[model samples]
Target: MDLKPYANYLRAGSAMIAGLAIGLLATVLSLNAGYGFNSLRAGPWTSWPHIGGADIDPYARAVISRSGEAPLGRDQGLAFIARTDSDGAPLDGACDYRIVDPLPAARYWTMTLASPDGRLVANPTERYGYSSVDILRKEGGAFDIDIAREARPGNWLSPGQAQRFVVMLRLYDTPLDIDSTPDPNSFPKIVKLGCA
Candidate 1:
């Protein structure tokens, strides 16, 4: 007798339910894609694509390295590689690190420590980077940079806690090939000196 009204109500309800389901599915797919891309790009096995014969890790390499390149050109080259402890996990933050390396031909080089979440460590001072320009020279022309929570007498970086930290290496005016093939050994290593 009143079938028309009932049918109209049913159709409207069905349409609303269908729209909600579609929206939920789209959201889930978007999130999955984002996480998947990030995982692959940041994973240890990933390598940078070849650009002008440069063997850089395009995704994880510092933003500064892409200067004059499309899209990311105005970005800073500040790529970080996580340092692990003897157990192969991330090193504790409260400990100090003696980061050392032989001088390179580039005009400048720097080592910066960042929290696991990619933010600068929250130390009393707002310092983050240790550059060759500021670090004291050592025997055999090598440089020793200290990273700890407290300020040291010489070149010091801040590692706010004893959890996970990343060390970013920046080499200005470095050859394209050098950027392409970043030597793992050249990066800073986290050696546990003591607790803060």
Candidate 2:
């Protein structure tokens, strides 16, 4: 009996398996850059509903473990991330952004701009984030931050040269909990300005 037919079938099966492996790898990489399926939305930002908790799903736990960064404990704080502007456009370094309006209830907070990989950007401005103590607030707990490569007065952040970026918001000592998520409207808004 000839073995040609069996060998051909084996080759086809191997190719299919390889394709599936590559697809899975790509998906995991994408998820590593963004939040997993347990994402919670707050206006333009996204967060892990199970942050700093041990009960996170397998995918979320994998991402957190692989990153090797310690998330604050449940009673410590919560972190939110935004990959797009208010219009649902990807945050681009070529464009400008305005983070404005009321923020969530917290004793203190900070806003940071980072790369898709969550690494701090390198720019001449040397500004990485804006803290509640440093920010200029308007009446009624409102504030505006200008995000661009160029110079701006008041609160400002630089995205460096990266084309795609993400913004991070950290709330310290907030009253919110896992079961009680306040309305997203209470969070600040990130609006994209004209691109150069």
Candidate 3:
């Protein structure tokens, strides 16, 4: 009996099925690994969506006020809160941010980008923060900050490959004209330039 044709067909079928199974397994494993890594990395800092008006943390409350100012002991310094999404959360990786100093004659200001893990975003230039003094501004003293995956022309800070990031604004020694109250008008407004 001639069984060569039957054997060849069986072998081909088995190989095809095996290849498909391997590919499926690989995809599932990759997804699982990615989720596990993110969970482990987030640890306790993973902020869930704020529900209702109760059970709010002090830090979250400060962020909600949009007043970047945080109490640094007895002294009252300049600080402004960065704006977030409609859900009262920080913008994800794709969104670009521009932080402008509210104080017109403010001498110094800085915007530092940090990863979700609370570490400074690593850049090739070894610079993790953007400062008004270091950035190039127009003659009238206007500068813009670009936060995205790729580098922009001026005042651009790479947010790394992470899906989440946070921007910390520091208005160093702001002018005495500004009020001490924590209000949205007291801080700089972070305008969304566009998507990366």
Candidate 4:
């Protein structure tokens, strides 16, 4: 006897559910979409300069918190990550690669290998990274870090059993300009050698 009113209520309920679902999806995607905006990209590397500043955006804050990463303060330094090779290929643990330096001007820097989720790779050497002072360099102050599953001479970093990895480069007390785009050539190049 009151079917018309009941149908109207059902239609409204369905629409409300659809709206909620859409809103939630949008929020998740936005937050996970590359650490907010204003990213400084150099070749395969990307840095969010403002994420460490006082005026950090909500999207950046949410991402950092969700990932459990404590970003360096703006005055302290800047951090960059490379998920791909110089040719724009995703870093694969099955492949051997070389990280060659032309690093930007900084008081100090460190390079580390981590899983995509930010955990250090479990290698037999128990070494996860190298700092500026500790990394092996050539006669001209140039350096290279070899990434491979097998042992390598000089500076080497193994991805261990990880199928994929990311390279994190952190600069401490860097003088590089944040207002302008940095030269991609100045940043280290990840060159893929061969694959297993």
lDDT of 2 by residue, 1-196 (tens): 9999899999999999999999999867865655466666777787775757766676666777778777776688889888888888888999999998688888999999888778998888888998999888877767899999898888888888888889999989988755655687888888878899
Which candidate ranks first by TM-score, i.e. highest?
4
lDDT of 4 by residue, 11-83 (tens): 9999999999999999999876868988999999999999988888888899998998889988999999999
lDDT of 1 by residue, 1-196 (tens): 7698899999999999999999988755653331122221222212222322334333333332333332112122233344564235456776776765643346666667776544677766677887767777766667677877778876787766536776655555544242344554544444557666
Q: Candidate 3: where are CA atoms >4 Å away?
A: 1-71, 74-76, 81-89, 175-186
Q: What lDDT does model 4 reach?
A: 0.93
lDDT of 2 at 91: 88
Candidate 3 lDDT over 59-107, as tens digits, reads 4444444433233211223433333632355667777766554433456
**On a 0 to 100 scale, what is the lDDT of residue 57 in model 2?**
70
Q: Is candidate 2 or candidate 3 better by TM-score?
A: 2
TM-score of every model?
0.54, 0.85, 0.51, 0.96
Q: Between 2 and 3, whose lDDT is larger? A: 2
Model 4 C-alpha RMSD vs. true structure (Å) is 1.1
Please, what is the whole-model Cα lDDT of each candidate in the order they appear?
0.54, 0.82, 0.53, 0.93
Q: Rank the candidates by lDDT, best first.
A: 4, 2, 1, 3
**What stretches of model 1 exceed 4 Å from their correct place?**
1-78, 85-87, 103-105, 176-183
Of 2 and 4, the candidate ahead on lDDT is: 4
Q: What's the candidate order when arranged by decreasing TM-score?
A: 4, 2, 1, 3
